[model samples]
Target: MTLRADAAGRERDRERTLAWLRGVSGELASATIKRLEETLPWYGEMPPGRRSAVGMVAQAGISSFISWFEDPRATPWVAADVFGAAPRELLRSVSLQQTLQLIRVVVEVVEDRAKDGDDVLQEAILMYSREVAFASADVYARAAEARGLWDARLEALVVDSILSGEYDDELPSRIAALGWHGHGEVAVLVGTAPRQLEVDTLRRTARHMDADVLIGVQGSRLVVVIGRATPRDDTPDGEEPVSFMTIATALEPSFGEGHLVLGNEVPGVVDASTSAKAALAGFAVARAWRGAPRPALADDLLPERAFAGDPLARTALVQRIYTPLKDSSTELLQTLWCYLDTGRSLEATARELFVHPNTVRYRLRRVADIIGWDATHARDALIVQSALIIGAMSESAATRRRPTRR
Candidate 1:
């Protein structure tokens, strides 16, 4: 009879304490919010809607503690009950450090108010605070992981749009979101994907070299868009800027065993699609040319690309090499045509032109200065010959299209 009476008495005491806690729950929540605004600068500056959500979390935390006191084994559910009251955006805006600070503030308020409560209530408060702290960290870690995945997907989308030569008004905004630092001149590089391609390592390597890249993997190929973040002083004055091929050479080891091609420079990132198209076209036909350099220029593969029916390569050959020479001097064109016809013999070219050998040498030097391609090399001679033939064919087609005199 005596044990029964004691058990009944303890039950009544617990009921009374729970009733008091429930009555003052609103008061406790208000005090916690007030304390948060005063103590936490981040909390004070939160927009009104978010601040209200945080207040709801604090209220729910106080309410959950009362429930947890009834069952000390309910530690696992306390964090969920408290945090679930807040909106999802709260987790994104509030960092783990700020969350821990909030936990500390709420614990202090609860502990101070419950000072005269039973020893079990005080012990429960301490245990609950520890659990909430760890739970807050877990929530924040998951949010960070989710955000990382989202950014990676966005980056991939932007890269895909650039490669496909598709553009809309949102491209600049998307690129800005990726924090692209390149301001001028962009070049695309295509190569075989490495066995273990570590993107972060590639970025670090590019940064060390004072360059930047946007990397993408398409099946067996790895495409990197290279840009100079800042100018380098190593280049001597009066010389052409360092070529993209040099940058490609430095990044060669990052790729798998296969040919690497760098496209011609474009004005800016907005023009990168042109460079990407050229690089991709060259990569498609790169295997046709045996003994291709490890880091080959896309322009160097013009003949192959043209033969593969790449219109850009054909147009580029006509305009860049042939038209420039044709518009510059007829003598230069005739000398080159004759030189190639005679199998690149200076004596034969000079005799055909009725000029001295030195005149032929002077004319060839002038051609080199104008087009930047030396006709003496066997490979360059082939490119020149292909450009001439294509240029003549295009001119003939245009002539036939023109309305003839009646």
Candidate 2:
């Protein structure tokens, strides 16, 4: 009985030793990782105490192996299976069993703490991975903070100017002062996210595209983004959502869903702000016509953009006006481009291309012969103009899925 009791006590001590060793190894592993983080692209930053505590767990696991009355090298390797690294290498040429024994230590500590809780290893990985991803949290925080300040200033400018009812004169200077790059033409982007959060998302998205963002927000649904559109955006036709187009498409799934609309670029924010209203109107119009899930176009709310965003207008025109030339060989697309560019002046168009006016006249005649409509007539001219615009904007010259105009 005495000998048996001694054996049981020894076994109990062995179990305790293993548990402690595991914790030490896990802590040491984490510290090694932390020490190597700045060099590895993956080291995330967190509170120093938290970092150290995690590292210490693995460190304890390693040290316990050396003192647990085992051939430390041989024993650490036995723990390799649990710690998930070659314990032999970890324990400096120790056999796999020695390392694996240490891993048993870690698993015991973790299992004890989390007896009825979630997986500690997984939780540890999650916590560690998150910390590592934002290694420069302070830098991003500072940037995001500055971005917030800028947004507040801009939002105030928009609301103040509009409230004072001086939108016309105050808008241009107010916007230009924000440091936007392009001067010739610019588009408008409205967002569903709040100004502060949306600003962060947009800034991140812009950084993804190697650019910066300028922003303003009015109410919950009104977010204004000012930046150069780039080819890098995955949106169709480079129409940014929230920032440039419908909010739904602009926001990544990481952000969730909603609608956004981009307005046509106007001369100034006076016009731009007005255009935003028009863009909202365009969204409404496009929705009334195409319903939700349809892409709203800039011309949907603009005057001359009628056919540009008008679905039925173009289709009716295509079927009624251009059926004759649908399969013709008279180079109709070229003919239409020339006609529109010249403002329907055969003499001017022919002269610009050094073609005989009679030849220009004859082509129009052939166009009429094929389509059974003379473009020289104002009604016919408008219909042909629709066809031309659609042709320029779409994939095929033959026919098109009327842009999701709403």
Candidate 3:
């Protein structure tokens, strides 16, 4: 009879405490919002609409706590009940840290009010606060995961558009959305893709170099479109902007074992197709050169590219080399031709031209000064020879096509 009486009194006291908590739940929510305005500066700075949304979330949290106090089985719905009260935009404008601060303020207000109540009330507040914190974290984590997947898909689409040279009006807006920091000049780098691509590491490396890249993998090939994060004019005093070739060399280790070709730098990203074409052409014919460097400039492989029937390479050789030499002076052209025909021997060249060896040597130096290719180097000799042959053939063809006077 004594044990039954004690149990009945305890149950009556619990029921009375529950009644008192329900009565003051509205007061608790009001105090929590007041405390949030005082303690959290971010809450006060929010726009009026967002501030109202936050207040709704606070009121919802207090009501959910009361429901949980009545029955512990409602623990699973505590987070949903509180957060679901706010607008969807609230999750975006309010950061996770700010949300936790709001939670802290609510718990503090509730704890201070329940101080005079039984120990069970204070323990329930603490447990409820912990659950809300975990739920907020889960909500933010899901949002971030969804955002990451969207960014990856958008990035892949941008890279595809760049490689295909298909520009729509929305391309600029899309690039801006991707947070592209590239400014003025852009270049393309082509190489073999590694067995496993470490995309994050490559991005980190590009960031360290103060550059930005758009990476794509097509079959076994990898293409990276690089741009300067900082413009040339904006570089600090006494420091020059890094050259594209130097940048390519630094990024060389990221590629698989094969030829790495760097295209000529273009004016901007919109003109990147020209550079991409050159890099792709050089990559195709890189093996034709016996001693080509691992990271070879597309311009340096003009002869090999021309042999592979790349019209751009052929035009570059003729326009950059043959035309300038032929236009400058016929003597320089003849000297270069004789020098190459005589196997690069100064004495043989001089004997064939019936001039002093010193004169032949002087003319060869002039050839290098005018056209930027030296007959003494075997590779350059081949390039100069190819240009002369193509230039002569074109001249003969033009002559044959001329109308004879009747």
| Predicted structure with the largest TM-score when compared to the true one | 3
Off by over 4 Å in 3: 1-21, 75-79, 393-406
C-alpha lDDT (0 to 100) for residue 147 of candidate 3: 82
lDDT of 3 by residue, 1-406 (tens): 9999989987787788789989998899889888988898888998889999999999998888888887879568666889987888998899999999888888888889888988778888889999999999999999899887888788778777877788787877877787888886889999999998988888788888888888878889988988999888889999998888888888888899999999999877777778888999999999998899979999989989988889988898889888999899999899899998888999999999999999999998998998888888998899989888888887899899999999
| Residue lDDT tens for model 2, 264-346 | 55543444555555555554444344333433444442323344455534444455544446557546657756877888998
Better of 1 and 2 by TM-score: 1
The number of the candidate with the highest lDDT is: 3
- Against the true structure, candidate 2 reaches a TM-score of 0.32
Which pairs of residues collide in model 3?
A: none
Q: Give candidate 1's TM-score.
A: 0.84
Task: Provide the clash count, candidate 2.
Answer: 55
lDDT over C-alpha atoms for residue 242 of model 1: 51
Quote the lDDT for 301 in model 1.
94
**Each model's total of backbone clashes:** 0, 55, 0
Which residue pairs show backbone clashes in model 1?
none
Each candidate structure's TM-score, on Cα atoms with residue i matched to residue i, is 0.84, 0.32, 0.87
Tens digits of lDDT, candidate 1, 1-406: 9999989988888888888888888888888998998899988888999989888888888888888877768656666888988888888788788788888999988887889998666777888888788778788887889887887787788778889988898998987887787665789999999989988888887777667888888899998988777543444587555567777887888999988999989877888899999999999999998978988889999999999999999999999889999999998999999999999999988888899999998988999998888898899988889999999999999999999888
Rank by lDDT (best first): 3, 1, 2
Q: For model 2, what is the C-alpha lDDT against the true structure?
A: 0.49
